[model samples]
Target: MLRALYTFLIVAVLSGIAIWLADNPGELVMHWRGYEIRTSFVVGVGAMALAAFLVLLAYRIVVSFIETPASVSAYLEKRRQQKGFLALSRGMVAVAAGDAQDAKRYAAQAHKLLDAPPLTLLLAAQAAQLEGDEAGATKHFEKMLAAPETEFLGLRGLFIQARRAGDRDAALAYARRAFGLRPQTPWAAQAVFEIEAAEEDWDGALKTLDRVVSAKLIPRDDARRRRAVLLTARAMTAAEAARGQTGEARKPALDEASKLALDAVSLEPRFVPAVALAAALCAETGRIRKGMKLIEDAWSAVPHPDLADVWLDMIEDESGYARAERAKALAARNPENVESHILVARGAIGARDWQAAREALAPHAGPSASELPTQRVCELMAEIEEGEYGDRGAARGWLTRALHAPQDPHWTGNGYRSARWSPINPVTGEFDALEWTAPSGVLAQEEVPAVAGKAEESVAPAEKEEAPEAAVDTVRALEEAGNASEVLAFQPPLPDDPGPDDEGEDDKGEDRREGERKW
Candidate 1:
């Protein structure tokens, strides 16, 4: 409404002016150089508007002519860039689709068209990798290193190639450079850490792990576990180096080893090896009471053979009876543990207590069809039969049962099973991967046995004149007269066949995929 009012006012004002102009009959006149010009006010205004329009049109035409060449150049450059990017995209897709030839063709076109070193060289390197052209891939990766933006990418590719070629030193160098360039990158950190660990460079690996934990690359629990394993490894290394040394020279190494072991146990109290090591160091330092207490506490929580070894070693010169008593004491601490029963059985064998040994192992005898006895239990039974009864046939029968018994727990990590403990996995080269447990396919095996069930306290008649009756039932199978050979009649079934072997498997290509560059 306001715009209409303004238009109306302007029209009224124009009408008044027109009326005045008409009434006055206004005109403009000019004379110069023997020429005379005359025009009305409205006619002159119309001529001026027409001349302004012509000037604006002429200015636009001149500017357009001047800009034409540059516009054409920009359009052509944009088209070239678009085509280069399209080729690069196609090459990546071809690589993903496993078409080496098409990937190579597109990569060459992209390399020829694109000026970006990282993008174009990356495509070229991937193409060469697909074609198994190591030389070509190496050249492209090397060229990428010349540009700052692609330096890390180049280093990653070189590192992977070195590893693939089985050049450990070269791989280490490349991994170190990559780690130095970007410490927080997971792949770089992992490569550096694993290589350092594999080389037995404990200090370097520990430093790398520290940085990884600080950067929160892994969970806090995992970091703690790794640190504990590293400390334990350092302790073991220090102990190994101090071997054969005597007097003051040995003390320093043992002290440092003890410190590391103690710190490891502090971080992971359930780690049996660390506990055993710490206890041994305590014993060496003449802290017998401390060591004994550590062993007792550890046994109460989790009984292990390592702990039993250290416990028996504390009184190394003790009599067989005394050792058996000590083993019995250890078992008393962790009465429900299967290791406790095994330890008691071992101690009984040492003391030549056939009845005690047989009784200790009888509970774990092959009775439950679903839950198989451990290899340890079967072996212990063999020992009891040979030493106590002097029966070779019975011992042989136990050996057959042992053949089919379930395997005992071992150090398994990253799908790598080892018979001995290591701070890192030899297969995956990962930290803290070696955990003390039974391997896969035995997740449902229970620790407590159904046969031997619970400990039933039996007081020797000598210790007390009046003792309560022990409710434990003795195994009649092995307790029969020497004339009875039927107890040895049964044996476990044989293991499944692994099928035929291929003798040419050794000639196959290495299965290490980590040593390859891929999209």
Candidate 2:
């Protein structure tokens, strides 16, 4: 409405001007060379307006004629783009559906029709992979690496291929490159970390782990736990390398290892392996008090047998009774835990304190106890029986019962089990994957024949019937636990000590006798 009103006002103003021009009757005329043209002022103005409209119409016609070819080309280009995109979409769908033939066909069509190399290369790679053409897939992925837009994807593909081909160095290179390109990418960071770990590149793994933490791909606690494991592993490797060095020369490495282990312990105090390592390293560096305090603090939080071993190692040259007293002190920090009781019992047995051993083990091993004893508890009972009374027959009976006893808790995680704690899981190549836990299933109890109304006393060592398939399996489980400890770094047992001295036996005899038992 406003546009119409403006048009009406303009027309009224033009009519008024035309009426005034008519009243004034002024001429708008010009005399050219050999020509003279004259008209009324109003008529000349109207003719000039008509001439301006004609000029505009002619310019538009000429411009439209000039642009016609370009317009046609643009229309064709848009149609081609639509077809190419349709092919790309179909190729992606075919790849997802696992249809190699259709994916290949669509990929070819898209590649021929479109100038986009990024999307086409990925589809071609996937199609080639589906067809088991690894070289073709690799070629496509390598081509993708030239384009910055697809470089990370290319690295990922190449990394996977290298891993599948069992080329760790190549895979690690690709993963690191990908990580450098995009540190925030979870797969790239994790791949770099795992490859570094599997290759035992502890420093590289730690650096990659820091990147992972910074990216927040994993939780803060998990990142700290993993970092602790990496540090511990590095410390263990450094210690091993320094083992052949003289004491004076080894001081620097030992110091570094000690720092790393203590850092690990600080990250995860309840982690038994780290605590044990820190304690051992501290003792190695002559900081025996610090080592003892670390063990005590960790034991109070979570008692472990390894801590006991470390404690024993720290108190070198001490008699069995002195060691037992130290173990008692350690156990005092966490008396409510069964592990604390076991620690005390192990020390008592080593000291030949029969009463103390029996009293410490009574709650878990005796017939009056509420539940069945574990394999370790039964083995300890056997140790006590033989060490105290030299009763081979009763010891053999206890060993027989141990075959069917409940399995003890061990460091189990990531589909691996060990009798000792480790910083990483050998199966999954993951840090802090192992935990102190029992096996999921328990063995069924088998009945033993009674002799003189005592079933444990009836089993004979020489009887072939005592060693069945189940006993073999139990032995195998025991062997697995003992061997798994050796699979990872920082898992060797603490320094050895002389066994408890029996009456009428020398130290050599005690050592020989202790070595005879099956661990």
**Model 1 Cα lDDT, one tens digit per residue, 182-264:** 87889888888888888878888889888998877889998788778788889888877765578789988888888999999
* Residue 382, candidate 1: C-alpha displacement in angstroms: 1.4
Which regions of candidate 2 deviate over 4 angstroms? 1-62, 211-220, 442-519
The global C-alpha lDDT for each of the candidates, from Candidate 1 onward, is 0.74, 0.79
TM-score of 1: 0.76
- lDDT (10s digit) by residue, model 2, range 1-519: 999999999999999987887689988787999788998887888899999999999999999999999999999999998999999999999999999999999999999889998888989999999989999999999998998998988999999899889888999999999989988888888888888887788898888887788788999988888888888888788877777688688988888889988998899888787889889989988999999999999888888888888898796788999989998999999997888889899889878988898888888886567789877787788778767757544465566666566667778776677776656677776766777887776433233222212522344644533333333344445545665564431121211111112234467866775665333
The TM-score obtained by model 2 is 0.76
Q: Candidate 1 regions off by >4 Å? A: 1-34, 40-43, 246-248, 366-370, 414-416, 439-519
